[model samples]
Target: MENIDKRNRLDEAPFQYRINKDQTVFIDYEGKQVKILKGKEAEKFIKNVNAAENDKAVQLIMAKITGNFKRGNERKKR
Candidate 1:
């Protein structure tokens, strides 16, 4: 398997998730809320996140879940 940590910088791990009391999951990117998952989807996401071996794995999971977050023409912030 490819090493995700190498492809993406550790400081650039922008994905974050929070589980609500109602069993819903809120996924965030760069401190912005991007996705909300509930029911079976939420459960599965939780399982996958919990099973992730490292931060990079979790970041990959969130990126896949959130679809394409980048547009080729966008410039990086300094």
Candidate 2:
């Protein structure tokens, strides 16, 4: 039953993000990470990212473009 869903809806915000000095970016979805980089490289990477990871990666990228992504943990500081 659980194996049915290969991907989840992009219903929520991104779970993680990272950017390298080379401008390569990475996003996390469902405990997995996907990388997006320079033109040709990015295209290839995107193809291998899988639907679920791609969804979250695109969501995070869109948030960055529109300035909607927020950083830091949601939990209260100890």
The sequence of per-residue lDDT tens digits that candidate 2 reaches over residues 1-78 is 123223443445534555567647565644456434566654444454444355556554433443433344455336
On TM-score, the candidate that comes out on top is 1
Encode model 1's per-residue lDDT on 1-78: one tens digit a residue: 365444454448888899999999999987889999999999999999999998878888888898876655776677
Model 1, which residues run further than 4 Å from truth?
1-11
lDDT assessment of candidate 2: 0.48
lDDT of 1: 0.84
Q: Pick the candidate with the highest lDDT.
A: 1
lDDT (C-alpha) at residue 16 in model 1: 89
Error of 1 at 20 (Å): 0.3
**lDDT for 26 (candidate 2):** 64
